[model samples]
Target: MYSRSIMAVSSWNDNGQKQFVHDPYELYRSDFFPGLGWMLARSTWDELSPKWPKAYWDDWLRLKENHKGRQFIRPEVCRTYNFGELGSSLGQFFRQYLEPIKLNDVQVDWKSKDLSYLQEDKYAQHFANIVAKAKPVSGVNVLQETNNIDGDVRIKYRDQSDFEYIAGQFGIFQEWKDGVPRTAYKGVVVFRYPSTRARRVFLVGPESLKLLRITDS
Candidate 1:
């Protein structure tokens, strides 16, 4: 649906294919493109709500009117724009504050047969103890060990999830080496989207080889 408030400009792509460009003065207001308008609208609302009083609604409308249709929407340029940051931030805010009311009424199955045996296992107790004692810093989630390569174990977390970390943050992994219990600081790596395959490489440190439990050929 074309908005009466905004102007649409049709242009040709690299293959000389005709495309309609929706130019909304605000990057967030352009609905001609998918998901762009929604992101901008939400972000702008969040940023403006606290500052703008109820009396400022007319001003908001005027701002939209003046900027609409004059802006250019270039599809090629849009590809380079970062939407992950906005999407992740909005998702986190919604999940924390506005999760569905139905979710509150749903009952959790605490006595499931799958988890019944976990209560009786000493190994589970040890694992739980380890988890309880482990303090997670901002970026580090889990530290695991692998023998596949010099920098095998990855420090996994979505950067856009309000959890921020540098590339070289050290994580300590507790595992068995030569039949002896050992703990070593392995390398850290962030997770990226579109490549959700297992064993995704993030960061490999020089010391990662020294911390390996098994020697790689």
Candidate 2:
């Protein structure tokens, strides 16, 4: 049978207002009480463990051996710290179980408000180095085609006689804008060649070539 001690009593008065009456022993058991039960348990452990003679070690070992699953009171509740003994005990328990896990190994890609990654010179330099290392194979023939209806420029190149470029490969385009030449980046090809034209296109605004700055590549 489980015994429940009435730690507190709340009553509704004639006007329907509630009032609370607390028992001293129950208050000691409560988180609001100071220097009792759980609070006493944790504090006593801390104090006695230091001053306790070496002779107590045998009894401590025996207690651990006997009461493996038993729950003990904590000092937080008995001390009336507002948070209560259970919170403190829970914190200790979680720490004991979780401390061995390595938090650094967890990979979290968080979207941050800070744009510091854009300003970092090392990241920029690393990207620049990667771009510098990439070398397109030379001596390969490239065919240029223009589409007036869609206002796009297309480039067709061959790996073999009948094959088109890979679906995801990017194409860089140089075109004229306002009588000056400008370079623009384009999206990857969506379809491979032989089914459709293996051509990659850039749909820059019309009249872009009026500003073309023609220079030898």
- Against the true structure, what is each candidate's TM-score? 0.18, 0.18
Task: Show model 2 residue runs off by greater than 4 Å.
Answer: 1-115, 140-217
What are the lDDT scores of the predictions, listed in order?
A: 0.27, 0.23
Clashing pairs in 1: 28-40
CA RMSD of each candidate after superposition: 21.7, 32.5
lDDT of 1 by residue, 80-147 (tens): 22235355436754343222111112233534424322222222343233222323322333323322
Clashes of each: 1, 15
Over 4 Å off, model 1: 1-185, 190-193, 196-199
> What is the Cα-based TM-score of model 2?
0.18
Per-residue accuracy of model 2 over 85-200 as CA lDDT, tens digit each = 35543675334322221112222232433323223233234323322332222223322223222222333233221122321232211222222111111111111122133222
